[model samples]
Target: MQDEPRPDELIKAVADFLRDQIAPQISGHAAFKLRVGINALDLVTRQLALSADSDAEELASLKTLLGKDGTLVDLNSDLAERIASGVVDLSTPGVKDHLWRTTLAKLAVDQPNYASYRREMQGSESKEAASS
Candidate 1:
């Protein structure tokens, strides 16, 4: 009898199939579109599976920074307010900078690399036009 494939093996097989068979035929923007679609779906799945404990380290660090003077709720509110007002200077070396960078990195990962791809496409178009 054949054994069932593990989940990791199944995921890897699907990724391999996409890379070898599917992505190769896609052209230009289509390739980036497919890659972004897959990345978005993967991120959604990961976010759905996140646990309450996932932010434990960040929460601990926040608590240490805030100290015993205020409630966690108040501290969170104040932090958001300061950040929104641009009053919080993240350029300085501290926990605030760490938090800002972590949040920004997550946002950066979600952004599509379309600007660079668009420029490349435009360059190709201009070259083709000139040649013709």
Candidate 2:
């Protein structure tokens, strides 16, 4: 196993340094570019922290939905083909929930700050609460 200060932590540290130390010293376009770079770093950090579990869950869902096994990319392609052929779609059990979950996972990594994503997350939390 690796030592302390893992990749995500290191990335967060770098992003924090850039935002706290470098960002204030910059101005205009440079500041904008720095902000973009910091955002990219933050996204990478989130992916590193979250992708494994999300990907595993997605893979499991896809395998169950497709009734077969393959790499995530291959399974997704197969699913797409099935959807295109009208053999599997929202009418299929698990398809709708799987798609919604996958979309939410992606949005969590890619656009967590987006208003729609936030709303969807809130709705999901409400549903979970109601079900409990």
Assess every candidate by TM-score: 0.43, 0.94
Residue 80 CA error for candidate 2 (Å)?
0.7
Cα lDDT of candidate 2 equals 0.97
Instruction: Quote the lDDT for 27 in model 1.
Output: 82
Error of 1 at 10 (Å): 6.1
For each candidate, what is the lDDT?
0.58, 0.97
Give lDDT: candidate 1, residue 85: 83
lDDT of 2 at 17: 100
lDDT of 2 by residue, 28-88 (tens): 9999999999999999999999999999999999999989999999999999999999999
User: lDDT tens string, model 1, 1-132?
Assistant: 447774445555665677678888998999999777666555554443342233554455566665534554576676678678877656534656557544543433343245754565577689999999
